[model samples]
Target: MSSRQNILTGSPWEDKVGYCRAVRIGNLIEVAGTVAIVDGETVKADDAYAQTKNIIERIGKVLEDAGASLSDVVRTRMFTTDINRFDEIGRAHGEFFKDIKPVTAIYEISRLVSPDYLIEIEFTAVVGEL
Candidate 1:
């Protein structure tokens, strides 16, 4: 069996909630729900499109740290506070995954950790031989 690895982001919530940003085992990497938080502040605030873009870029870094890349992503889950903004969110998502075409699901949620955060995303990736 492969050993487990944890990727931490040093977010206060990670330590308080006892969760890492991502975990990798064997050839699979699972990134935790991510928001557009940067330098201890939320980015893009109420903008779903920009928030989605930031979160995806953050996830990309986590994937790279786990020895994988966006192309290796097999699935994605997005949670948003506003379904009405889906078009914007979808556009941002398509910009990143249109070519890779990872299976994805977007859901409208009541809220997030912060009211300023409009979206949160999670990703699952499998590392294949390169």
Candidate 2:
């Protein structure tokens, strides 16, 4: 069996909560639920579209570090605090996966870890080694 690999972002929560940003085993990578947090604050706090876009871009980097790309993503799960914002969030998701069209699910939850955070996303991807 291939060895397991862990990807860490060194966020305090990773240590405090004992979780990393992502993990990869062979060709499969699972990125942890991600929030659009930058410099200790939520990005575009009130704009779901901007926050979703920013989150995807950050997730793209994490995937790249794990030897994969957004196109390699096979599934995505999104959680949001407002169902009314679905159109904006979906528009941002379509921006990246319109062609890739990965399987996905978006849920309108009551809240997130932070009140400023309107969404959190997770990704699963399988890719060949480079």
Report each candidate's C-alpha RMSD, comma-separated, in the order given. Answer: 2.4, 2.4
Where is model 1 more than 4 Å wrong at Cα? 38-42
lDDT of 2 by residue, 1-130 (tens): 8888899977899999999999999899999999886434545678888889898999999998888899999999999999899999999999999999999999989999988888899999999653
**What's each prediction's clash count?**
0, 0
Q: Candidate 2: global Cα-lDDT? A: 0.90
Q: What's the lDDT for all of these models?
A: 0.88, 0.90
Best by lDDT: 2
Models 1 onward score TM values of 0.92, 0.93
Which model scores highest in TM-score? 2
Steric clash pairs (candidate 2):
none
